[model samples]
Target: MPSQVEVMVKALSRLLGWIYTFCWSASFYPQPIYNLRRRSTKGLAIDFAAINVLGFICYMLYAASFLYSPLIRKQYAARNPISPDPTVRFNDLAFAVHAVILSIIVYSQFWPQIWGFRVSRYQHVSWPVAGLFWGCLLAILILTVVVVTQSPDGGSDPAYWAWIDVLYGLSYEKVLITIVKYCPQAWVNYKRKSTVGWSISQILLDLAGGVLSLAQLIIDASFQDDWSGVTGNPLKFLLGNVTILFDLVFVVQHYILYKSSGDGEDDNKAPDPRTPLLPEEQALQR
Candidate 1:
């Protein structure tokens, strides 16, 4: 039997969890919509989409394994002996699955044949960026093979523990991917001096999600009086904060620095938004 205060706190935590899940999941929609209406992915970074798809896939793996695998849960308990509160919630798993689907949709928009959208010739992901995504995928593939080969038996053997470690490593990989994924988009916005193709709605929703996510973690940890719930899962904590920082960067790029001017609006329908501004055209804007 729980006390009244305990019940209320648990209820509040659940509410926050759902709200942030909705926010983060819904955040994926605006970009595809924006691209559809614009009929172009001119200012959107291909690298951003590529990296985002991979990141969410990793997150899905992490959440699903933790929630479904008793062995993995055992591994978590072994690693973190102190904090015993729930780290991965239903909402977290839901968000991860939703994000992975939406991220794939968004990434598909980058290709001309898939969505039949026009993209500027200049709008291509650099070789290094492509290499980065492939490199990450290869690492995940190799580790997956190791986990499969090493954990043939279901017992709590060393090989089984190694598989658990790989699952846990995916969580950290997601955090790293989140940190890197934003860079290309931010750089694109800076280079173009605009955020015309990028969706600010996505950023706003992501910010809401990130803030609520961090708040929910704090509340749950406090309620359990087990700070290890937050501290032990440092990657999750770091992911929320890192997402918030990049969302802020995008907000500033969209709202503060490169806000649209009526006279020089970046036409969404333009076949090539990457066309360089002539000296006279640049002078007039100044």
Candidate 2:
């Protein structure tokens, strides 16, 4: 029988897991809402959305691996037969799947706005090209996972090296994806000297989710002594922290540093009578 403390910990872990799942899932929507309201994706990076989709896909795979990996499932069953499922709840899977869908919606918003910006050269790469590149990379990763996990030697043992290969490879891919996912948008914001089109609400929600996720990890580590929950998947440990850091940076940029910036705001401002207006501005004034 589990101790009272252990039971309490398990309950707390489940509660935190659901909360974190909801927060993380909901966080993906604010940016899309911001884009739709503004009818612009200026200051937002398409690459960020692309990479976000890939990252979420990798995370989903990692989560699903817990369900399918016999080694992991067996360990969980041995440890706690009553609730032996190692997989995250279906709700968590829904959250991850929704995030990916939201990312695609956000990615779709980029092109329409980019078309409106009459610049000599587009700042970001072509969307289709970027999409293809990421698609190919994801395909390669899937193939590698299938090949390794299907090996005869790998199937012979739950603790086979190939199992570790799949687990760690997906985990590391998630880490890499998370590390680079925010860079494009951050760079754009830096170059533009503002985070105008980006939603502050999105950052706030993401920060909330990240903090909660980290707390969930702490709860697991404290109650279960599941260091492997983190060490085995350092990305899972680091993702929330890194996201919080970047979200804070974005908050500072949007609210503190660019508080007085006229870049995004100027889009709605009336044309100055004293200054000659561009053709587009003249049409808008009429």
Candidate 3:
């Protein structure tokens, strides 16, 4: 029989899991919303989305791998036999699916507009090229998975240690992806001196989700007396803080740093009737 304290902790953990799930799933919607509202992908960077898709693929694989890993499952069963398995859950799967779908949507926005800018050296890369880049990345990921699964010793063979190493490496790659994910967008905002097409609300929601997710982990680790849940996945811990950091940088850029520049001019001055609407604006007007 479980102790009263264990029961309470389990219930709290479940509740926190649901909250984290919702926040994580909802975080993917903001950029798509901004794209729809603006009807343009002008300032958004394609590489960021491309790299993000790859990172999400790795994350999905990592989560799924945990579900099948005998060692991981056994560990969970031993630790909390009465409670649900924590390795992979509906919310975790949903987060993975949401990420892939969102990445595809963001990638799709690069077309047609990219074609229009083909003559410019700055916009030389096309959607197809981006697709090719993603294809290469996908191939590499598939190859890695194949190698991991085919290990002769399987999970038990010391040779199988390579598989664990790969998983850890992939997790670290997610951290790297998170670190660089916002760079291109930030650069775009800087060069254009505006964040008009970006959604600040989305950033706020993302930050909120990240902070809550971290809190949930802290709670679980605290009550369980097993810091391995954290140390085992350092990237997840780092990801939350890193996300909040970048979001703050964006907030400052949008509100203070670029307040007097870019679209700020348009906000302050009367419209010049002679100035033609941007392609996206024209599309919306029509």
lDDT of each: 0.80, 0.67, 0.66
Report the C-alpha lDDT of model 3 over 168-214, residue by residue, as the tens digit: 56667677777876887788788877776666667777778788768
TM-score of each: 0.86, 0.76, 0.74
Q: Total clashing residue pairs per candidate?
A: 0, 0, 0
Per TM-score, the best of the predicted structures is 1
Clashing pairs in 1: none
Give me the runs in candidate 3 sitting further than 4 Å from their true place. Answer: 71-90, 113-155, 158-162, 260-286
What are the candidates' C-alpha RMSDs?
A: 4.3, 5.5, 6.5
The candidate that achieves the highest lDDT relative to the unseen native structure: 1
Q: Which 10-residue window of candidate 1 scores lowest in summed lDDT? A: 261-270
lDDT of 1 by residue, 1-286 (tens): 9999999998998999999999998899988888888788877898888888888888888878778888677766776667643477888999999999988998888789998999888767788777877887787778777766767663354436366667657777788889888998899889878777788888999999999999989998888788888865665688899999999988877778887521112354344467666466899999
Q: Give the TM-score of candidate 1.
A: 0.86
Comparing 1 and 2 by lDDT, which wins?
A: 1
Q: Candidate 1: what lDDT?
A: 0.80
lDDT of 2 by residue, 5-63 (tens): 88888787778778877888777877776666666666677677767777777677777
